[model samples]
Target: MNGIPNELTIERRMAVPRDAVWRAWTEHATEWFCPLPWKAPEVEMDLRPGGISRVRMVGPEGEEMNLTGVILEVVPGERVVSTDAIAPGWVPQTAFMISVTEFIADGDGTLYRASARHWTDEARQQHEAMGFHEGWGKVAEQLEAVARRIA
Candidate 1:
């Protein structure tokens, strides 16, 4: 995919096979989807185009953040693309960003890439200011740990 001016990209290399990584992602998502102190207690994924992908992140203090989106693409152990611009059944929502997560074979492990394509440069900047890298990086590390355990 061509780089978009309003996109934020992050990648990591994990000592886990692509299938293991994908399994951890799709099956054990709630265990590692959020950074520590903020857990995802609710997660639902239809795993198909136009299907719903939802998560409710709960902070240690009981604060909650809800995310509801529609899956735009899914490539099994390879890639997933989703967006908050639309909900299931093609319902429109307040547009935020599109997220893409990719898993690639790398030696005996996997290369993981995650990106967010914001609707505007301002939105991208806001995401950065909200600790996107640090937060998402933590999630990736947690994901790797979960994958290792499940692998």
Candidate 2:
């Protein structure tokens, strides 16, 4: 609260058009969004303003983490904003967060960026210590693959 907020900004170049990148963020593409070495078992996406997307992943120990959020805004082939407020059925989130994802055309490809906003400085530090870079980085790498496949 006294200093500038801490955040993680990740940028990746995808060998795909903006539209293809959009698909990878939608319901049908949740599988690929799962960072490798983990398996996604379920995905439900309602891709529109106020719509919701829920994804369930299975860890190595078969533990499942279900994440769900509502779409705050969606600009086809441009950007998507979503709040990690509630889970499926509008259940409260254990760790609240908001995400803004953008896709910029980079001449024959797209520049993809996703930023996460937390409520407190401590939360931000916690996320950083938790390896958001490695976790999200892996997912971003997977995103490039998914986008290229459909490009």
Candidate 3:
């Protein structure tokens, strides 16, 4: 897809197969969801539309960030879209971004892309200023490592 004014993306090619990457994403998210030294101690994922998707991250200094969202779409091992636009049971909430994560088979590995689409340019800028590149890139590398281990 072409660029949207309020979207930020990360694209990575993993040496692990699609199934392994999918497992790393859905079944073992806490293993790689957050960057090292900043662990996702708890993760709750139900890979279905409207299902709960939660992650609790704790940094080296004990700074915490809890993300609670609902899965908005799922395509088995291929794709997942989640957002904080609404809470469980479709309740309205203040939304910052919608995350779209996709994994596709490429040779013996996977082509992965994750995009964060914000409702406003200001929100997108906020995410970027918050170290989106360094943070999310580390997490993606973390996911690749976890997947490689089980591959």
The per-prediction CA RMSD against the true structure, in angstroms, equals 1.0, 3.0, 1.0
Any residue pairs clashing in model 3, and if so which? Answer: none
TM-score of 2: 0.85
Report the number of the highest-TM-score candidate. 1
Ranking by TM-score: 1, 3, 2
lDDT of 2 at 76: 78
Candidate 2, residues 20-83, lDDT tens digits: the string is 8777766345656667667787876676877887778988878888788888788877887777
lDDT (C-alpha) at residue 62 in model 3 = 91
Cα-based lDDT at residue 45, candidate 3: 84
Candidates in order, TM-scores: namely: 0.97, 0.85, 0.96
RMSD of 2: 3.0
- What candidate 1 gets wrong by more than 4 Å, as runs, is none
Would you list the rank order by lDDT, best first? 1, 3, 2
TM-score of 3: 0.96
What 10-residue stretch in candidate 2 is worst by lDDT?
Answer: 1-10
lDDT of 1 by residue, 1-151 (tens): 3667898888999999999999999999999999999999999989999999999999999999999999999999999999999988898999989999999999999999999999899999999999999999999999999999999
Task: Flag the better candidate by lDDT, 1 or 2.
Answer: 1
lDDT of 3 by residue, 80-149 (tens): 9999998888888999999999998999989999999999999999999998888889989999988998
Residue 11 Cα positional deviation in candidate 3, in Å, after optimal superposition: 0.5
Clash number by candidate, in order: 0, 0, 0
